[model samples]
Target: MFKRSTLSLGGTALCGALLASGCANHLQQRSEHEERVERKLLDHTLQVDIGEPKSLELPQRRIRIHEQKTFEVTEFEVTRNYDRYTPYQPWRELYEVPLGAVAIVAGVGANILNVFMLGHLPDSVTKDWIDNGVAGINPFMNIQSHGRAQQNLASIDEVQRDRRTESTSLPWSERPVEVQAGTQSYTLTTDRSGVLRLSLLDSPFAEQDLSHVMRLRISVEDDQDNVRSDISLPISGSLRGKLLEAHALIYDDLEDDDVSQWVHRVKRLSELGLEEEASELEQSLIELTHNDPELQKQFLKSLTRDAGRLVADPQASN
Candidate 1:
C-alpha cells in the first residue's frame, strides 16, 4: 500500500511539471510572434517615378520627379463597438412589459371602434412600444470609428511616426534636384506639384554642342537622406533632325522667301513641335510684313500656339 501511494505521488508530480513546461513554451512562442510582427510593421519602401516618355517625338519633359511610399503591415488588431437594438431588452423589461400589455389592449379597442370610424389606422398605434423603439433605425450612419483610424493602426505606428500613407500619392514638392546634361550641371527646384519644368532652349542644352550630343543624363541626389536616382535618355536621330532644321530657320530671314511665305514656315515649325523656333521666326515675319492687316489676317489664319500669340498692329484691329 505504501509503494502504491509513493508511485501515485510521483505520477502527480510529473503531471505538474509537464503542465508548467507547456505554459512556458506557449508564452515563449507568443513573445516570439509579437517580435516578428513588430519588425514587419516597420518595413517601408520609397519609389521614384520620373515622367513617362514626353511624346513619340520628344523623350521626356525638361524635368519631372514624383515619389510614392509603401508600408508593410503584417499582424494588426481592431476594436469594434456597436449599439445593437432588438425587442429583447431585458433591462427595460419592467417598464416595457406594462407598456406592451397596455398597447395590445388599446390596439384591439381602437380597431373595433375603427369599424364605424374611418376604418383605417396607422401602424404606430398597433405596434408595441418594445418593438417600435426608434422603429427601423438607419444603420448606415451608426457605424463610425472612435476617431481617425483608431484601431491597431496605432500599434502599426509603434514609433509614433507621422508618415505619409499610400492612400494618396504625395509629390516631392519644392525639392531641389541636381541635373547634369553634357558638360553642364545645374541645380533645379520642383514646383508646388513637385514637377520640374525648364524649356530645353532655356536650359544647359542650349549651350552644349548638339552636333554630336546624343544622350541626356539626369541624376537626383540628396545628402540629407537616401533619395537618389539616375536616368539616361537617348536623343533620337529624328529629334536631332528637327532641332537642327529649326536652328537653321532661325538664321534665314523670313523675307529670303517670297511674299506668299509671309508666315507659312512659322506655322509649319510650330506644327513640328518647335514652338521656340517658330516664336523667334514669327518676330521676323512681323517685321517683314509690318503687321499689314491683310497679311496679318493671313498669318493669323495660319498660326497656332506660341507663334500665334504675337500681337497684330493697331491697324489690323482698326
Candidate 2:
C-alpha cells in the first residue's frame, strides 16, 4: 500500500513538471515571434531619416520632397482633381472666306468689266465725275480733238527775215558785237532786240566759205515773244582757236578777281573733269543767286554759254 501511494504521488509530480515545462516552452516561442515582428517593423522605420521623431498624433499621410531641402505631406482625401485646360484654335474663327475665293471673285469681276468696256470709255473715272458723261462714250473722239487743237503755229520764215533787217540797222556801241581773230579785233552793230547781224558782213571768209561761221542767235522770250537777244558767231579754223583762248582768259580773270571763296572753288571745280561734282556746284551757285540776283544771273548765263560752246566744239575736249 505504501509503495502504491508513493508511486501515485510520483506520477502526479511528473505530470505537473511536464505541464509546467510545456507552458514555459510555449511562452518562450510566443515571446520570440513578437520580437521578430518588432525587429522587422523597426528595420523599415530605420530605412528613412525623418528628422527627430516627434509625437505627431495626426493621421498617417504620404510625404514628398517639394523642392530643395523641403518635404510636404499630401493627404489623399484632402487633395482635389481638376480637368486639363486646352486652348481654342484661332485659324478656324478668323478666316471667313474659303481659301482663295476672295481673289478669284475679284479677278472674275475685273475681267467682266474689261470685256464690257474695251476702248469706248476712259480707263479710270473719279468718284466725283462718275455720272457726268455716258458710260461708254468713244475715247477716239478725245484723241481726235487733241490732234485738231495743235494745228496752228507761228510763221518762222517771216519772223527770221524781220529779225535780220532790224539787227542790221542799229548803232555800233549800243549793239556791240565783238570778233576776236588771232589777237586782232573787230566790232559790229546789233538790232533793236540786241541781235548782231552775221550775213550782212562782207568778209573774205564769207565770200569764199560761209560755213566757216556758225551764226547762233540766242533770244530770251517771254510768252513766245522775243524780249532779249544775243548773237554768237563762232568762226572756224585759227579764229575759233583765238576766241576760245580769249574766253578762257576772261574766265580766269573773273575767277581771280572774285571775292567769294565759294565762287573761286566752283570755278576751279568746273575746270576739273568731274561732271557730277560740277553739277552740285551749280546747284550751290543757284542758291547764291537768290541773295545776289543780278550777279548770279550773269554768272549763270556766261557759264551756260561756255558749256554750250564746249559741247558744240568736240575738239575742245582734247
Candidate 3:
C-alpha cells in the first residue's frame, strides 16, 4: 500500500510540472504576439495622408474684342495677382507724406488724374504694384462702388490644394481586424481615431505620385462575431504640380470655346518667359485631350493641317 501511494504522489508531481510548463509557453506566445503588433503599427504610420487639398478661386474678367465686323476673339484677364488684397484710395490717404500737406495733396490729385486718363494709379507709398496690364485690368480700383458676384460652382474642377496631413496613429485590436465597407470586406488595423486605414502594402508608387482615391469604412461588429455594418467614406486625392492650376482653365471653357484661344494664350505666356504658366496651360491642354478622344484627334489633325498658320507664320493667328 505504501508503494502504491508513493507512485500516486509521483504521478501528481509530474502533472503539476506539466501544467506549469504549459502556462509559461502560453505567456511567452502572448508576449511575442504583442511585440509583433507594436512593430506593425509603427511601420504603418507612414501610410496616412499629409492633408486634404483646399479650394482656391481667383476673380477673372473676360473681354471680347471685335476686330472688323466679321471677326471677334475672347481674352481672359485676372483681376489681381498680388499675394494679398489691398484697399484702393488716394496715395495721400494711403501713406504719410514726407512732404508738407500742400505737396501731398497736389501729388494725390495728379495721381488721381493719371488714373482717369491712363486707367491706373501710381503705386501707393506703402505698396509697390507689379502691373500685368498687358494681361489685362488696371491694378487699382477699390473705387468705392461696384459689387462683385462670387460663384461657388458645384464642379469637380473647382477644388484646390492646401496643406497635407503630417502624421496618424494605428489601431489596437485583440483579434484579427476585419474592416467592412458596404458589401466589401478587408482586414486592417484601426488608427487612433478608431478609423481603419488602408496601407499600400507594397510600395508600387514609391517613385511616382501616389495620386489615387481611397474608400474607407467605419465598422461595427455584432454579438455573433460578424460585421453588422460598414459605413463607407470615399476620400479624394491631393492636387499637386500644375494639375491644380489646370482645373481653373478647364472650368472656364464654354461649349463653343475655340482651341485657338488656348494656343494664343500659351504662345503669349511662352513669349513673356513665363515658363511655369506656359507649362500649366500646356498640361491643361494635354489633360483635356486625354479626357476626350475626339478632341485629341481633332487637335492633332489641326496641328498637321495648319502647321504653318498655327505655329510657323508670325502673322498666322485667325
Candidate 4:
C-alpha cells in the first residue's frame, strides 16, 4: 500500500510539471506574436511631419521699357532698356495728396464751366460729373454712384464701349492677366497663333494634394461677341481614373467655372474619407511616368506642360 501511494504522488507531480511547462510555452508564443504585429503596424503607418500649408506669393512682374528718339544730324539709333516703374513712389510726400485728386479738380472745373456756359447741363453730363468726382468724395454719394457704374459695366457691350471711350483702356493683348483664389494664383496668356496658355503663378501646395479630379470650362469671346463655346474637360485624376467623368450640364466658360469644379471634387473626396488615398494615387501616377518613356512623352503632349512640370518637380512632395 505504501509503495502504491508513493507511485501515485510521483504521477501527480509529473503531470503538474508538464502542465506548467505547456502554459509557459503558450504565453511566450502569444507575446512574440503581439510584438510582431506591433512592428508591422508601425512599419505600415506613414511617419510624416506635415507643417502648415505655405501661403502663395506672387512673382515679381517683368517690365520692358523702350525709348524712341529722332535726330536730324545723323540717322543713328540708340536703344536703352529701363525697368518697370510704379506710379507711386516709396518716399512719402511732404504734402500728402489722396489718389485721383487731379481728376477731381478737373472734373469740378468742367462741371462749373458747363453750368456757366449752358445755364443748365444735360442730365447725363451732370450725372457723369457727380459720379466721376463730386459724388466720389462723399461716402454716401460714392456708394450710390459706384453702384450705377458697376451696373453699367456689368453688361458686355457697355464694358466694351467704356473701354473704347476711356483712354485708360488696357491693352489686353500686351497685358499679363492673372487671377487669385484663396492661396493660389494663375497667369494666363495667348500665343501669336491664339492658343491659350495657363501657368501657375504661385503654388505652395503639395503636387500630390493637387491631383484630385478637376473640371475645366474655357470660353473665348471677341469684340463683345461669343467667338467660341464653353469646353468642359476632366483632368488631374489618379492613374486608375485618368479620364474625367463626363457631365451633361453646360456652364459658362469662365475660369471661375473651372474653380467651382475643383472645389466640388475636394468636397467629395473629403466626404469619402479618401483624401489620403487620392494624394497617394497622384504621387504614384507621377512616379510611374518616369519609369515609362512612352507615358512621359504622351503625358506631356496631352496634359498641359505646366501640369507635367508640377508633377515632375521633387520639391513638390510634402
Candidate 5:
C-alpha cells in the first residue's frame, strides 16, 4: 500500500511539471510573434498629417451722410385805378378822353412815383427788400462742418497664399532623403527594417510646431547613392493607419524673402551640376508661384536661363 501511494504522488508531480513547461514555451512563442509583427509594421509603414492652409478675413466698414432743407418766396403788387375815382381836375373833365387811355396814364404815373419814392428810401430798407424777395431772410450763410463720418478697419493677419494642398507617396525607408518646400528643407534616414526617420540637421520642422497636415516633396538616395525622382504629397491624418510617416519642416508663414533665398539656392545648385537638387528646387518654385502666372513665368525664365548655362558649360561647372 505504501509503494502504491508513493507511485501515485510521483505521477502527479511529473504531470504538473510538464504543464508548467508547456505554458512557458507557449508564452515565449507568443512574445516572439508579437515582436516580429511589430518590426514588420515599422518596416512597411510611413504615416503623415498635412496642415490646412492659413487665411484671414479682409477689412470692411460702413459710412453715411444726410442733408435736408426748404425755401419759399411771395410777391405782392399794389395798383390804384383812376377810372374808379372821378378825376380831381374839373378842367380836365371839359375834354372827354377815352376811359382806357386815362387808366393807362394813371398806372404809368403811379409806377414812376413809386420808383422815385424807393430811390429816396433808406439804404437799410431798400437793401432788405432787394435781398429777401418774398421769403424771409436767408437762414444759412455758407454751411460748414468740421466733423466727418469716422470708421476704423481692424488690422488683419496676413494669410499664407503660396501654400498648396498636395498628396503623394514615398519609399521613405529605402534610402537617405531630402525634402524642400518654400524655403524649408528636411533630411531623412531609415532603420535596417526600412522604417523612415528625419535627421535633425537642416530639418525644417524640428523645432517648429507640427501640423496634422503638411505639404512636402520627398527625395531618396538608392543603394548606388543616386537620388531618385521626387515624390510630392500631403502628410495628413485622413490616411488609414500606417506605421511610418513624414512631415514638412515648416510651421511659420512663407515670405517673399524666403522665396528669394530659394531662388538663389536653386541657381547655386544648378551651377554645380546637381540636377536632382535643382529639379527639386524648381518643383518647389512652381508650387509657390502656381497662383501667380507672372511670377511663375519669371521663375521659369530664371530656371531656363540657368539650365541653358549648365548644359553649355558642364566642364566649367565641374
Candidate 6:
C-alpha cells in the first residue's frame, strides 16, 4: 500500500512539472515577424532641399531640411483591448443613449413634415438630426468631453514592455546647427519649421568672402550620429562672384558719389539681380536729395527699365 501511494504521488508531481515547462515555452515563443523587427534598422536622415529664388542672401533662400530621426527606435505604445466607444465620456453616454432615442424620433417627425410640406423644408434640417441621432445611438461620439482619453496624445512613458524597431518619425525641430564656411564658422538655429534661413549679410559670411569657398559644410551637433552627420552645400561660382561684387558695392562710398555715379550703382545692382539692395539704395537716394522732386524724378528717369521701376516706370533701353 505504501509503495503504491509513493508511485501515485510521484506521477502527479511529474505531470505538474511538465505543465509548468510547457507554459514557460509558450510564453517565451516569438513570431518570425517579431524576430525580423528586432533585427531591422529604421532609416533616419536630415534631408536638405535647395528650394526657390536660389539667393543665399534673402529669406527666400530655400535651404529647408526635412529632419526625421527614425532609427533603432524602441516603440512603447500603451495598448489594451478598448471598445469602439472608448473616446466617449462615461457620464455623457448615460444621457446620450436616451437623448439619441428622442433625437431619432424628432428626425422621423422632421422628415415626415418635409414630406407633408411637399419639400418646402431643406433636406439638411432632417438630415442633421438624423445623423446626430445615429451617432448618439451608435455609442461612438460623446456630446460633451472632459478630455480624459485625449490625454493619451499628451504623454508617453514605458508601460507593459518595449517594442523594438518600429518605424516612426522623431521631429527635428528647433535644433542648433553649426555651419562652417572657409575660415568662418557660424552657429545657426533652425526654426520650428526646420528651415535654416542663412542671413548672408547678417552672419559672419558677410565679412568673409563666399566667392573663394567651393562648398560649406553644416554639421548636426550633439545628436544621433546615425543621421546625416555633415551636409555639404555647394556655392555656385556665379552666385559667389555676384556676392563679391555686391559686397564691394555695399562698402563703397555711395554718399561720396554724385548723381550719375549713384545712378550707375543702382543700375549695376539691378543688373546683378540685387533688386532688394537696389530698392534700398533708391530709398537712400530719395533721402539724399530730399524735397528735390525734379532731381529725384530726373534721376529715376535717366535709369533704364533694367534698373527697376521701384520709384517710377522707366522706359527700357535696348
Best by lDDT: 6
Candidate 6 Cα misplacement greater than 4 A, ranges = 1-44, 52-60, 71-172, 199-202, 222-228, 283-295, 304-310, 313-318
> What TM-score, computed on C-alpha atoms, does each candidate reach?
0.42, 0.16, 0.18, 0.17, 0.21, 0.47
Highest-scoring model, TM-score:
6
lDDT string, candidate 6, 179-243, tens digits:
89887888888888877877554446778877788767878754555455576766667777788
lDDT of 1 by residue, 123-214 (tens): 54544322323221211111111231121111221222233323335666888766665667778788888777754444455555554656
User: Looking at candidate 4, what is the lDDT of residue 142?
Assistant: 25
RMSD for each model, in Å, please? Answer: 18.4, 52.5, 41.0, 45.8, 46.8, 19.0
TM-score of 3: 0.18
What ranges in model 5 sit over 4 Å off?
1-193, 197-254, 258-262, 271-276, 307-318
Tens digits of lDDT, candidate 5, 119-170: 6655434443332221111121111112311223323223222322333344
* lDDT by residue for model 2 (195-254), tens: 343331134223233223443222221232223333333333443333333233323343
Worst 10 residues of 1 by lDDT: 24-33
In model 2, the worst 10-residue window by lDDT is 24-33
Clashing residue pairs in candidate 2 are 167-191
lDDT of 3 by residue, 110-209 (tens): 6667666684654542112112111112222222111321222222211222322333333232223454333455554444444433332112212223
Better of 2 and 3 by TM-score: 3
Collision pairs in model 1: none
Per candidate, the number of residue pairs that clash is: 0, 1, 5, 0, 20, 0
Candidate 3: misplaced stretches above 4 Å?
1-256, 301-318
Q: Write the per-residue lDDT of candidate 4 for residues 1-318, one digit (tens) a residue.
A: 999999999999987665333211000011111111111111111111111222211111221211112222212222322222112222212122232354467656777878777847664554454444533343222212222221111111111111111112122243233333234544455444333333221232222223342433333333332222333333323421321121101112323433334334333433343444334433444455566666545543433332222334432343
Q: What are the runs in model 4 whose C-alpha is more than 4 Å off?
A: 1-187, 199-209, 226-228, 239-318
